[model samples]
Target: MLRARPKGRPKATDVELVDVVVGAPDAGHVRVENLVMSVEPYMRGRMGGEATYAEPYPIGEPMLAPTVGRVTASADDTVPVGALVLHERGWREHALVPASECRIVAHDDLPPVVHLGLLGIPGMTAWIGAERIARIETGDVVFVSSAAGAVGSTVVQIAKLRGATVIASAGSREKAALARDLGADIAFDYHDGRVTDLLRDALAQVGASGLDVYFDNVGGDHLEAAIRVINDHARIALCGMISIYNAETPLPGPSNLIKLIWRRARMEGFLLRDHLDARGEFEAQMATWIRMGAIRPVHTEFAGGVAGAWDAFLGMLDGTATGKAVVPLGTLGAGTHGGNDSLDKEANR
Candidate 1:
């Protein structure tokens, strides 16, 4: 990201993929050639030159993300060469990350892309929001906006696992069906009409008074809708607001917020980094869920390596991706033996 896209939506033309030579690792660092890099909606905030929970992305420097790569060279004993590792130095072909910061991957039965998808940051975000923040209780009525997306998809599944009836909304009918396949009790097309009416209709069909937890990814109208009909003491797990992330001027706050005041409902925003203490538990539960066929991750892979990264980022932010979008960089996963064609077909199956 060379310059901030302050005026309008960020475009591929705004970023420059300038190459730089890589040197040997320092005493405690390991050089990792990224096999895959993630393109998520949160990156939009970092590149917008605003000070939020995350720092503004530095111009004229390599952008960063959670990257999975093989240790080509290492000066640390714990992370030796040839080991598959995960770190946060993406946006370039290779990164020299601190040994302590990298985690050794031991996955075999599952594809490595899971490190960037269901078991990755998005997965963690989903779990933390549903379990920790929203506390989605059993039999609770939960609504997740952007339910076909990486985080929202996971939230839909997790909410089901916790025995909640999930009402999911997506931009299209296909995505809504995807959410239905993921076990949502009701899935609707948010773009076709007013989401608040659709939600009210869905709840009327279910005979529920109001939603217990509104796990929001697409904010705007969705937030307003949830605010319109929340149960007493309901929770709004404020996650990504992708609908408003690229907006130049501030959108209006929900008019029905007085309902929150009247119902004594709570809306709390969270960052995944703020809840690292629960990651180990989350990983264990996610692994078991994957093993027992409790969850299936949806993923969209970009084969254009680093060059197509910008378009992939824009595509995901623009909500074109069928699932969690990522750029498959260097060699596929360590044990995974396949070309780009096979890799693309293998994901989300």
Candidate 2:
């Protein structure tokens, strides 16, 4: 049971928290004590009544995402009672879920949060886009938008692993520098005037005619520039368009899409849900890379109880969060539940 409404964006709907009890696990069901909650842009879409990759959050319904939790009880013998699992539990202290919906996580040296991030959706999205959609190869000039964000950063690392020369874009100069530090051959500030000119120079600096593959995250203008700068027979993985996400009005199609016809470029868009069946294989590969120190996971954590979950979610919507924004309910934030309350109070003073 919880005491108050979940904190989130001003525009957020379907937000609340209060008295709830977990029932004993039934056949194929497992009860979990959630330890970490993943705050992501897709969740924001659900809050806004926006129809993106999934359905909008129903009013008064509990919001859910990929959460790491400890199994307190299990009805299914296949899932042990003490195992750690990741399931589509919401911003709550506990959950009861189906056994098939959860995956056991066993990487001890790696932080459990990585299972919500690098070793999870962000990592897999980058891997599939680079390996399958874009078909990244040695000597290929790959351009990635939102290079400093979770999925974008993962793409940069995996593309580098594939021996491709990487060019990345970020909204700020500081983020651009961070991308460069993360092995990007070139980094550009997207907020600067004349993005196309800036990108042309980046391509020219690399002694390339045009980009062979593009990992797109910011789709509007960035997509426009990419269309103009792609080589013949290029490939593009349309990840997401954060720029148009908040627009009250509808967005127009890419103006430079004609390049696709002229250059015979292949462009495709994907949703993470489509790849859920292959979670085991993706986890195996990502865990190896994380354990090998070949990849680094970054996150911005917001310390707040269940009440703070709403605010942390809205923070991501406002572009205030750098990496993954998370809320550790019951342990941090405005509520006084335990030892975490003292830290929250002292910080306030």
Candidate 3:
């Protein structure tokens, strides 16, 4: 529970992890021992106390996030005891989840963490952005922004799998190299210069036509660049605008947005929750890609329980951890600290 809402950047003191004892589950409810908890960029918007296709996190309440766990006890037959499941009542070691909100996903071949990263929202998000939103095609020239992050990196591999020429952008040279290692045909650092010029030159170097599709994860400068060089009828999947996630107010709009009209291009934003209708198909295809070594899950795992959640979340907000930020909430990892009051006082400063 937050003692008070944040004034600027959030602090460890703003959040306190209170213990909630989990008694036996009621009928139709399953008690789960959480294994892995997810911390993503969207949670930052939730903490801002404004609704953006979602509601604000209520103060003095147990925080909510997608969690993968094992059913220690079950009151419903569909979710039997000892089955692994995914639920949204994370932020803690144990949770009582409604059977409807919990999905059984116990597979010995695939670890539970995969269900939270590549095989989960991040992977599905990339697939939706490419196939559904951007409509990537064979022989198409594609550009992905924030290409070192979870979703953008997955977008790179998925584009390669679909036989498209993948152009990936990262914030630093090291990240750009990682993008190239992940099969991006061309990887450039967005910080090098105006990304517009870089995209144009990279296209020339590769002897490819202008971008046919753009998997846009960084919106400000990257969006402008993509709009500037996009081919006629090119489509853009507006996945995120992380460059401005911390801005106090609206920043400047892309100067080249008019290119959308000039080139007859299309840009659309999407949330993976709205596209779950494709989950069954995405899961099967993603499994195949994994078996064929087409897609690799990239993420950072923080080995602290719920007590470390506030710090782990802060680390993600500061861009310290690459890919998806995951915290392993083992039973022992949970009981190490009392709450934010126990956090290193220096972290609060």
Local distance difference test scores for all models: 0.84, 0.77, 0.82
TM-score of 1: 0.92
Q: Which ten residues in a row are the worst by lDDT in model 2?
A: 340-349
Looking at candidate 3, the ten consecutive residues that score lowest on lDDT are 340-349
Structural similarity to truth (TM-score) of each candidate = 0.92, 0.87, 0.92
Over the stretch 242-291, how does candidate 2's per-residue lDDT look in tens digits?
87766667788788888999999999998777877767777788888888
After superposing candidate 1, which stretches have Cα over 4 Å from the reference?
A: 1-6, 106-109, 333-349
Per residue, candidate 3 scores C-alpha lDDT tens digits across 120-231 of 8888999999999998889999999888888988999999988999998987898899899999999998778888889998898779879999888878878887788889
For lDDT, the strongest prediction is 1
Better of 2 and 3 by TM-score: 3
Q: Candidate 2 clashing pairs? A: 7-310, 7-311, 8-310, 8-311, 304-332, 304-333
CA-only RMSD, every prediction: 5.5, 4.8, 4.2
Worst 10 residues of 1 by lDDT: 335-344
